[model samples]
Target chain A: MSPSPEQAAFPEAFAAALREPRSAIPARLAARPGVDPAVRFAIYRNNMAAGLGRVLADRFPVLRRLLGADFFAALTDAFIRQHPPAGPVLLEYGALFPNFVERFPPSQHLAYLADVARLEWLRHCALLAADAAPIDRAALAAQPPDVMARLRFTLHPSLAILRSPFPIVSIWRANIDPANPAVVPAGLPGENALLVRPGLVAEIHAVPASRADFVERLQAGVALGDATNLVGADLTAALAFLLSAGILTGFFPVSDDAARRSDPA
Target chain B: MAPRRIPSLSTSAVPASRPTPAGLSPPAGVGLRPPHFRAALAEPGAVDFLEVHPENYLCDGGPQHHFLTALRQDLPLSFHGVGLSLGGADRPDRRHLARLRQLVDRYQPFHFSEHLAWSSHGGTYFNDLLPLPYTQANLARMSAHVAETQDCLGRQILIENPSLYLTFAESEMSEAEFLAELSRRSGCRLLLDINNLYVSAINAGWDSWAMLAEFPQDAVAQIHLAGHDHCRDADGGSLLIDTHGMPVADPVWDLFAAIAPRLAGVPVLIEWDQDLPDWPRLVSEASLARQLAGNALAEARHVAIA
Candidate 1:
């Protein structure tokens, strides 16, 4: 029942038609004579684009509500046309939508949209990341100094830290929850925050600038002491903050022989 | 290419304990969502199966996982995938396939199914079930794709017919003919959507009855009933859109009644994604399907007795 080898060329052409609205065989095929096929095919194209646009709008509801419906519609259309889906899993369709909004010309006025999108994307990533049991705090405390040195701490899979200039949390809260004490902090300042799923819910919290730099270094696998010094005297506070947040899961200590082999000093 | 071997079985993804599919009756079941998890669990045997979207549970642990676990304990479950993109021109997505296989192993679902449309191409995902033109090229491609999917998942997958918006002038065959061909070529079963048949038929100006007649009933394993929306074209002509928000229209129900007699006890599922009613209301909608199937069975019995 499969199509013969001779008929296998239709898929390429069909794929093209699905991509470009006006790129199919002559419109007259639907109804002959230099008649307008656009009017007939236009409905299909409109429905396809509009339906997909609405999907993006829904996925990025906070973004849409901020940008207003009409602007979001135009942006969604352009994004879909330029970047059609590569697979059927639409759960990830808008992975780059936030970046698209940031780079979009009309959206230059709304500066915080991209950061908010980044936060949403990270939230989605955190939600789907591999689940890990919370690290054994008691075990960490019991390890000797030398054994702990080799330990490479493993952060919870659901942890993501974001730094943004705009008061994105405020904006996101206002548009989504509304009644949560609206406080629009002074103009867009450099902001750092973490998104972690401790239980089942993804919680977002702002991290101080020093803690952001320290955690970034720790996440890079630097020695604990060296990573601590990265934040000066606040190293203890930063490490405690991250540990208490349940972001650090477990550590893999380096073997003594391997440590000795790498000891250049 | 030589038919690739199916993946080895894994039990990590399926429920710890599940009854094998044996002499299972096609009892009425409502599409399971988070909102009704409590009510669904409260009433034992209220429904026969709980169908969950596998994509929603791809996460390691979350509210979605919590509800599915709780519901899995009390009822038989089915894994319905919305993102396999099995009809795409390229090969099946390996990562998506592995994740799905893992979930199947964990859940040990009684049945598994996916849509007959492609949602992704080139790296971008559309999130909507986009239709394919029924051409020889597409049929061959889809058949291979379905085979590939079954090979990866290590089980037979039922492919549901899609509700299309437009027809391609270059189509070499009807949608029903294409599906029939794919089923034969891929060795996969069919999940016929009578509502989709009616909707697509109305949208593309095809004869609904003729299309249904052409459908490969022998391959059918399940049936889907859902509501659709109506839109007017420039000429004021009506277009029935497969929106899945409203209640089943009367004409679609009539079509189902007409076709039910021919099918050999296909499992029926009522899907209401958008404008969802209260749990009882949705249960009532599924009850109607059970009622109709019951009536058909009774009529058959009467014939035998007579």
Candidate 2:
């Protein structure tokens, strides 16, 4: 339905007030005798900026801490103006914040900030993601030898593989937990983080390049043998890590179904 | 007050299937925040019941879900919603309604409530409960949306009057009249927020007590008390902001005291969303509300006997 002129004007004026610092209150709004429309409008503007800023801070605490309060507040204000939340769920509100940081001019010097933000977002996602029952080792052990090669594993719903060019995992851990203050030694390379929520607690594990590649391949729906082939010598260790971390939720035999339906060419 | 007539449609349409007495009793509670979850779970009966914003607990799994599940087993839950946008141009979002339904089904909360304001427009949702023009078109839209929300949840939901900073020139009806008509049309109840009434009264230059007298007391299913920030307008007059960051202001408490007796057996919630106090502090506020409610009930009984 088309909006009533009042309905149409109310949100438009309110939204403009929220976005622009100096926007006049729409003509339709009546100011109390003593109150200026600008003063009244500022309350809403402050609420929009501060509310979204809080959401960003809650999701990206380490980043906020690193940037300090004022800088973080200004950055979130700019981000909120650009992208007010698309929906009511604050849990998923800051998906683009890390990307915004990547292109944000003032923060360019801090090369690792975006990656750290990505790690934080991943952790946030892992925390709220659905719970999944881990695959039992005995169930996997019961699979026939011929079926093993064709098995395509389903990772836990909360599992996330994040690869960053900076030593983001250490930075994230150090910044988030004061006890484990990250001391970045010189000449350290990039890191890959494996995020998982086996139970209610979310955990982040650092993985080597080979294991990261293997996990990425598995995430891309590669079968067991194919994924293992991509990792070469790291296959055994990666599989052990996956199983131990309760990352694999279930698996299905892909080639076995085709093999049973027709003779191998 | 001659036992203000319960709207006949409300009595006939709303089901009496709710199993717990939580829906029927006047228990003072506080908004359940994450910081106080441990204290809340440890002593569920510390207050009469607990109110939580369903949007905060919409996630599939987390410590939030875990503790809330445990808390539900003890105290009755009130799924007060902040995101339904009932007065928006469009009907309530189907996806959000479904999520609310899932929560209602799981928790069986004794009360479900949403604001009378709109928060979303076109696709973007402003985090705040944005204001609405009380025009006939807007009223029709809001009433239909409330009914739809009630139908979706399969229970009567409470519509909260928003704390307004500015009034629209096109508003055709007073907030009380709009809310009363909405309750009549949609078979929904009211969540009369005392803080909001006080703030909006001051901000809009209306008499707070007179506004309370006009409010549909019989339809009030719950009451919300919160603290607001006092600011100075351009002309140096007092401007009240519903910050929900402090203790209930004295005037608001007075209004609650006056209104409490009229709306007997309605749950009162102390809402402190920002600068949240310690668990004991919030519990103390709830205890105060309980005392006030108890006194009001007694006075109401005394008047009835006399």
Candidate 3:
């Protein structure tokens, strides 16, 4: 009763059949009697394409709202067929969809669609990312000033830094939450933002070029002294600002010996 | 001077006891969706029970958990799992089952259910229920997996029939026969989805009623009714797609009315997964089933009165 080698290979055949249209199915499959295998097979193809499309839409609601339903549906179908689900979870299905839309021939005119999708994706990631307790203010206050220079900060799992050529945050906020006013300029050069889950809510923090660079350095686990030099060499002001905003969650206590070995400078 | 204060939740709250019931039959219930949580809680009504997917409640403490907790207090619960992968040829993923069991222990749902389709193969998770070849080998594998799941949870589970689009030439037995045999071998019950039966019947050119008639009557514990999309095949032939949006079609309701009397008051749920409507619309759909159930009860009472 074990499935033969041919039977085990059905999923591969199924995946192939899904990418091609009904007209593309082999004549031999259609010639089968009674059940009409071609007819049966087409239903699955549609389901596979439509199901993936729905998952992508769920991941990027603002993109769908902005692009209109019909356009997003077409783009989603194309992306899903070209790139089938790499994981069993639909939550993990559309990791590359935003990038796909960016380069897709038909969608090239809508350059900002991809950035809107990225914003939605960052929100999704923030929602499902692992939970961690924010750094206690008392712990930071307790650390001696001498050891503070070597503290390597750990960013929360939900933190994501993105810079886009369009004012994507305004675009996303305007479509999804209309309480915020629409982007008056409609088109603008690159804006930077941080996506983070502080409580249960996912918040978009609009940071300046300076803060973004500082966060990038700390995220790379660069020691405070070196990271300060990399960003602007004004550690005191930056540290005070980040701590006040609750942006720096926790810091790894790197001893003087370990710090010296890691950073010979 | 004010006393020093420490921030803490109610860490000393004692865990509640969970009640487990025996046998197959389920009470009438509604599928709990996210949008309907407020309406469900605010209104006063008699929905015999409620069911939810354990995957949606995986977080430790969140809004979803809060809703599930509130609903669990009011009605009997059923933990229907969507990601268990019981029919996968590979070993049943223990982590998924353990998480489900943890929910079971916490909520102590009256019933637990999963489908008889493989969703994961070679580590690629399709997330959609793929058809299984109803051969003896698959039956044996699924039986063992079901037994393992039941043992892990320390309770018997009801396995639902899948909605199939294509039939494999390699399948050795009909789906009903295979499911009946699986129940016999694995000590599991059945969750009969009436809409799926109708959809599969139309697509595969089989008798929907005959399919249900063949299923083991004693093994069936619950029923599902949902809407489907009607489409055409490659050769312009008719096909019914099991898309769980929209209202329950007329034919599905007719089938439920016909088969319900025979099953002796099995719990039926109205499932709408996509394009979800407002609370009243979904509730009205459930209300239709409740009306049917009420009619069945009235007829039974008349027979007793006679």
Q: Using TM-score as the measure, which candidate wins?
A: 2
Error of 3 at B213 (Å): 2.5
lDDT tens digits, residue span B1-306, model 2: 544333232212211212232222256788999889898888776787788999987898878888898987777778889998898876789998998899888888878999989888778888898887888888888999999999999999999999989888899999999999999999999999999999999999999999999998878888999999999887888899898999999998899888877776567899998999998899899878767766765676778899
Cα deviation at B8, candidate 2, in Å, is 20
| C-alpha lDDT of residue A12 in model 1 | 48
| Model 3 chain A lowest lDDT segment of ten | A25-34
DockQ of 2: 0.62
* Local accuracy of candidate 2 as per-residue lDDT tens digits, A1-265: 7756776687766666666777677777775776666678778778888888888888898888788789999899889888888888787789999999988999988888899889999999999988788887898989897788888877888889898888888777777864554354347789999999988788999898788788778877788988887778777777888999988887877765654345211
The collision pairs in model 3 are A88-B125
Query: Model 3 segments beyond 4 Å from truth?
Result: A1-12, A19-35, A65-71, A102-114, A131-156, A177-187, A215-265, B1-26, B41-48, B56-76, B88-109, B151-155, B168-170, B230-238, B261-265
Which docking category, incorrect, acceptable, medium or high, applies to candidate 2?
A: medium
TM-score of 1: 0.81
Q: Which tens-of-lDDT digit does each residue in B58-151 have in candidate 1?
A: 7777566777877777776777888877877667889889999998888888678988887766665656676666777778888998999999
Tens-digit per-residue lDDT, A1-265, candidate 3 = 5756535554555545555674454333321245566656666666777777777877787787777789899988888767776544455567788899899898798787788788888788776665556777788778887777778777777778888887877777677754543342364666787887756677887666777888898888787766777457566777776665456666766665564455412
Model 3 clash tally, residue pairs: 1
**Candidate models: Cα lDDT each:** 0.72, 0.82, 0.72
Candidate 3 structure quality by residue, lDDT tens digits, B1-306? 121122232221111112213221224567888778888887526466677877777655445666777876666677778777788776677776777778788888777899988766555555577776788878888999999999999989999988877766667898989999999999999998988888878777788889878877779878898899887766676678788887888888877776766664567888888888887788778767867755654565567679
lDDT: the better of candidates 1 and 2: 2
